[model samples]
Target: MNTSILFQNVKLGPFELKNRIVLPPLTRSRSTQPGNIPNDLMATYYGQRSGAGFMVTEGTQIEPRGQGYAWTPGIYSPEQIAGWKKVTETVHKEGGVIFAQLWHVGRVSHTTLQPGGGAPVAPSAIQAKAVKVFIETGPGQGTLADPSVPRELTTAEVKELVQLYAQAARNALEAGFDGVEIHCANGYLVNQFISAHSNKRTDEYGGSLANRLRFLREIVEAVSAVVGNDRLGVRFAPLFESTTEERVYLGLVEEDPHQTYISAIKILEEVGIAYLSLAEADWENAPDLPEMFRKAVREAFSGRILYAGKYTVEKGVRMVELGYADLIAFGRPFIANPDLPQRIANNWPLNQVDPSSMYGGTEKGYIDYPRYAG
Candidate 1:
């Protein structure tokens, strides 16, 4: 059989990947309650997908205040680190390299998801629209609520958050992760600081593009300082258009996404981080990352590049062959086929993902996926 481009081995910073396929960060909300810690089930879920060249744990909050949904895991406390140790140990035993994605939801959350039922925090005191946050409604079920009006972080508080990101990276190291990926995308905290719609301050951290990028720059610097540039990655979800109703989440598309993200990538390039993970829109018939943007990313950053968002094996191979992306992340496919990379390798049938069980559930759809036997 002629192997696809995704089957090729690649060097990603200090770690070398067995193939060009990656498991991108996904939010399953299966972490233990109260403490929001990773557990054995989560460990098994990740270990089952170890055939991928690399795996990034779901968006793990940097602090309790960082969480925006019920049951989402955190990487802040000692207990959380201990829980993640099991996950990392399992993946390592299978010879897989993994990175922990540190995240904060900013204003895209309800007060119910916040500490003391407090309002969610953001770059500005704006309420996010067209987005819903999952809150605990019962023992095993959750409900989606509209985001609450957020409190704008003062300049001092903003700086404090950067330190939190650094601390999270240190915690990830303690948890045995190979590296850390800064969740600077998806209308989250870092993205809120970058998007003009969410950040309306007149201070140094807002107004111009350079100012909007200040938070992300500071975060990358702080996290890299702890994890080293060779062990850090940044993710950015650049939405090019919002013509459809479904595309209005957090209303985050910049006036000029190409220029905005290109400049952001330039900052990452200057810092010499390990990789840049680009997340495209996942709706059906969504456009691919524009060729111009892809070229700009390749030219701006010297590190490895990863792309995600409803990617298929054929599309992944094509992107690799075109030199646009060094690795491809399959989200839904990985959910149903824990052995996704091996299945692709041997042309095995993939299990269909049950959308109902995607967010929070028991072991039924979480770790029950079968492996290919050829």
Candidate 2:
């Protein structure tokens, strides 16, 4: 049988993926309560989708202070590590490679999600606009609330956050993950530092583009130190333009996204990380990353590159054929079809994802997604 590019083996740094299809980081918020630890349900969910070439766990908080949404898993505590052990073991048994996405919401968090009811932390003291954080109001019920005004992190505190990221990498290793991916996109803490509109600090962590990239550089360095550069990955959401108000969620579009991302990928090149994950706008009519930006990414980074954002099988194969993207991640499709890669390969029908069960839910939409019968 002729193999599709999506099912072909590809080298990503020191590791070689069995295929080119990836299950991108997705927030299901199904972790156990009290500690927001991964549970059996979460493990089953990941295990069922182990057919993908690689899988990245949902945005996991590096520390308690890193949390912004209720019920999302964390990598800090011992219990959380134990919980993730079950998940990683199951996926590994199925011959799956998985990475943990270390995340911090920064100013995009509400006081309820903060420790001791404190404000969220950011490079500058600014309130995020047009974003809502989910808070658990009761069992099986959550509501979105406006984020609190964040306080600027002091220089010492910024260094501490770097340590936190490194520690999370260690925890990821303990939890049995093959690697770790730094969440530097989607208006999160790292994104805040990268954006001129969000980072208004006068310190070394802000100002020029180099200064703005300092935080990301520090975190990447620290994390790479723990997980090894060859096992480290970075994710960035570079939007060129927003056709409507939804574009505001990620932050102001960079004047030259090509140059901005090329420079960022250059940092990854120097760091010698495994791969770079670029998340494009997923909304309807959203533009794909420009051809120039795609070439710039390939030229700047020597390692593999993964792209996600409403990707279809044909588009993914086209990107791979064009040498633009090494791997393609399917998000919503994987949510409803645990056997997405196999389904695509055999031309089988896919299950439709229920948007209502996306955020926080039980076994219904979490692990009950049936595999292809054919």
Candidate 3:
């Protein structure tokens, strides 16, 4: 047996994961259109990657207005729930633990992707600049478009969104998922509320940092009530350095990211959730998260910690060995190598990911990548 620490079994709340490798949530827009329903193809794709100790499904829209991309899946409708059941059943058959990532794009959306062509909703009326959202122009065709200006959410609507997140957690359990992870990262609905840049609300849900965090606190508490804190995880993209404009659009790259995120994490600690997934800046040549912040995170959060974004096997091993991360989520690497854990354990060569077929496509790049055959 491999003696690498990464290969050792670890406890994540009620579950004992077989290894520390995780398949992070990746948005592959292959869901069946017209309903944005998960399909058999998605099941096959996820089943192939079940060697992961933990898996999180793509950013599934929590409601109709929550979608920002073409062909992504949703968890609100009955048919969508049944469709995800197939995916969960397949992953369970392979002895893999999977979590559904509840998502709402919020202002990172085009009017075309909104319900009834309405403006996307946010904690404040703002447009996410320097970013593009995918929209289907015709069958089998799509193009990137600028995000539409979003309308501010009424205080009641914000509270209703918390209930929607809770309902999505219920749907995830009903669909046979092992747990659910809230997509609070990447300047989505939850992140927008947290960032002062986007959330310019005058209501109780905005202004002060505590007010900004109120939405996340409410959603976490509500969802935890439904799924139990042990079965819930929250993700955040905390970029401390502001090198790129896209990072500004995606994460809002808070002026004091360290303070904003550490404060957010303290709330998770209070709820005692299963795990905290932190996503670093992934763009090429992106600066590594400050060592100071990593140490702070370990000190603040008592639960298991996960880190994703452009991590290599050596880097992941180092993080785990240093006790900064309990799990390492592999995004692109997992996409090209379904048997990623085995390859890492054995030091085997990895398959290269195809950028052309990365998004919405047939099985070519989605599931056709060959496993190591030595």
Candidate 4:
């Protein structure tokens, strides 16, 4: 099969990517402790994978309360900003384009990860079920625990969160990132507000579909003011009932995912953002997105669309050829093979990812992944 389409340049917002392959945001939990700051080790990891046309950093929390997992980096502090600067600089040196993924976990967090051990905040007072959050137990030690029951965010606080997202975008730009992608997917803060099951608010920020999307619309506009719309992207994981129970834990399966997400995509389209990324179910035996839904998304949104999750070269090429996706992100494959694009180009054998060292560790499974020897 012809894989050349994956190597062709494509326009994304104001920038033109070298290829259509993307390095999607994958949480490695390797940030430096005490402040969750990015470090040189992380810089090395990204630099090694700079061959991709586009790359997004691991989900970097916009504020302290936004963290649900231990040791994930943040974009809220000056020191943290400087740390990320090193990462962006490294990628730039290799002539790679990178974007910082601004994130907030909402109620999918334990109290230990919150400010003053306070309850995690959400659109409503609901505890996330069937999910475990990673928390630091000690220096270089951590364990997964149940998410704490969350308190409802006041109307005023919801507006404040919008400004926080804008500030995070400013931070990302200051750190020399090419752009920023908002983590609005996978049961994170933004997704919590969008999911009807998680958001039971009666305020203008919830209830109706438009109201539920109000938070997202405001955030996209707010962040776009700081970083132009051409440099802003949003990610969404629209889960359906077809997903297995275990895989659906990250984001609640919506009753009408197609209608819900199409409405959300329309909002992004209205704002004229650079791109929209949709993360599909990645588990073995997981189903592909419905053809009807993909077609609907293409008709609803005019900007570039990205799809990630278990995409092989052939599948990615087909999606690009079919015009369903403008880019394909390879997550775990890029994790184990830093020269992933080259491997795909050359048909080289790939190194299997070491699952044990996937997160919060020394640079064993990270930068140590060697390129093909042949």
Candidate 5:
């Protein structure tokens, strides 16, 4: 098998990865209920895929109102923090570095997942479309339902949310995670504030580009203060097109996506975080990000840059070799291939994910994927 740059050791902030292969944060609704807490089963699932040089936990809600889906784990509660400790300890035992992805779904949530059945909050009261949020119906059961209209968060509430982000970072550290990643991507809360289409607020959090970026800036400051900028990473989903795709809701495309994301990247640069993760659009036939934007990103951010979006091994190696990205993340592939880095290094056969058993399932699709026999 031909060797690739992806197989080489790389320095990601303070940690030395065995290779550049990364497992991006993937949401698997397998957490135990009653509190949406991480459990032994979830630990087993993450531990099985610890072969990656760096692993990011599934998107963990920072608070109850931040939850958009059913059965995902949280980082705010005492039990949730303890539950996550098992995952981090297990990954460490396997000689892998893992980071907790701090997430807040914002308007992507439903009242069923909110506190006291209140409306999910966003920068504005706009309702999200073209996507479904998983809401628990009964014991161990969930359904994809349309998102409800969200209430615009007041300025005071926004500040409190920033503090909550800092607290989440503290909880992540308490859980023994090596680092944390602020989920500022994929049309979530931070993205909601950034996109002009969703944010109609006239306050400092909305309107002009500078105003739109305030929420993200505040979050970076808060999280970095607790986790230290060197141990923090921020992820952004920058989609340049709105072409119909399986998951259309992720694209918070703007008139000038290049400018929009460059500005966002510049903030990460100013904050001096460990790495910047840019998630490209995965929709079929989606327009590839222009070479110009990629060049701009390279110049704007001095720290390591990671890109994930249906990346192939050949593509990842080429990107790294060309200096476009320092690391690559394998999402769906990691789900079905526990020993993904080993398989990639040896060019072994990969398993196809069973879409039917992807979410809200037992160990069937989550932990039953066999490693390569070769």
Candidate 6:
């Protein structure tokens, strides 16, 4: 594999990517409490990873009812806006471009995380299995618990959610983000609506594949109107597992994933969006995404395609060389090595991440990971 290919600059919509390396959105629940607001610490963490060609922020809740995890930042409040302003400014000062990932966890949440302690909302009154939601038990303390059953949304509320997504796009721009990515993957809100197992709604928003994708189309269209198609992107985690493997929590393997996701990408292509991020199933022994499916995605989608899973420098360069993906995202590796791109380019030693301090911690594991020793 030609390692240099990963460092080459490429055009990504209106803005040019400094390299083919991307920093995908990672959820580190460290925002200030009482009000889920971004802080200086969060800004420091992102600023450290500015070497990426493009970076997407952690899942930022679009509204109060959208939050599913404790201490994850929201985009609806004035304080949240100001707090994120610091982050955008810091990243920009480091010569990096950043995008806000708009997110809603849907039924994969406990009632404690919902507004008024209400049951989380979904396309149907179903509970997500195998995954646990983080709930704040006390000051600076949280616990993992089973998700609660959700309440089905009325047609009117679904319409309002479309408006909410648009407003969140406006908020992201107000907070100084270069663009926004709709988080329609990982069995979250949009994914729940799209999945046949999670959604049993008999309304226009469910039933057929086209009907199931209606909510996603509406949010993408609504968000595009605000951010413009050139500045918008969508992320879809299409899990393709063999029959031998057990179904995972975040990525529910679809019976016809190729059709499901290619159709989804076609919608984005018609809208003329900036890029599409396809997150591969990242679990141990997860079957590799089929080459035929990859080739089909490249042909079906017109925009740039970015991929992330458990990618190494060699594997990433090979993917780009094989003409499958345009950009590669380093998730956990970036977590441990802030100057990850530089280290890879120079073949430098990397730091190992502290598993214990990975989620909801102080700056210990966040920004304290040093660069390659000289």
**Poorest 10 consecutive residues by lDDT, candidate 6:** 242-251
Clashing pairs in 3: none
- How well does candidate 5 match the true structure in TM-score terms? 0.98
Angstrom error of the Cα, residue 335, model 5: value is: 0.6
TM-score for all models, in order of appearance: 0.98, 0.97, 0.98, 0.99, 0.98, 0.98
Candidate 2 lDDT over residue span 29-146, tens digit each: 9899899999999888999999988999999999987888899999999999999999999999999999999999888898888889999998999998877788889887888888
For model 5, residues 25-48, the per-residue Cα lDDT tens digits are 999989888888899998898899
Encode model 1's per-residue lDDT on 1-374: one tens digit a residue.
34467888899889889998889999999999879989999999999999999999999999878888899999999999999999999999999999999999999888888889898899999988878888899887788888899999999999999999999999999999999999988889999999998899999999999999999999999999999999999999998877564433467888899889999999999899999999888888887778888988898889999999988777877787778889899999999998888888888888898888898989988998777666
Off by over 4 Å in 5: none
lDDT of 3 by residue, 173-231 (tens): 99999999999998899999999999999999999999999999999999999999999
Model 2 misses residue 263 by how many Å?
Answer: 1.1
Model 6: number of clashes?
0
Model 2: worst 10 consecutive residues (lDDT sum): 243-252
> Which tens-of-lDDT digit does each residue in 1-374 have in candidate 4?
88888999999988889999999999999999889999999999999999999999999999999999999999999999999999999999999999999999999999999999999999999999878899999998999899999999999999999999999999999999999999989888999899898999999998998999999999999999999999999999877654445435464788899999999999999999999999988888777889999999999999999999889889999999999999999999999999999999888898999999988999888889888888
The number of clashing residue pairs in each candidate reads: 0, 0, 0, 0, 0, 0
> Alpha carbon lDDT of residue 20, candidate 6?
90
What local lDDT does model 5 show for residue 338? 96
Residue 353 CA displacement from its true place in model 3, Å? 0.4
**Whole-structure CA lDDT of model 2:** 0.89
lDDT of each: 0.90, 0.89, 0.93, 0.93, 0.90, 0.90
Between candidates 1 and 4, the one scoring higher on TM-score is 4
User: Between 2 and 4, whose TM-score is larger?
Assistant: 4
lDDT value for model 6:
0.90
Candidate 1 CA-lDDT value = 0.90
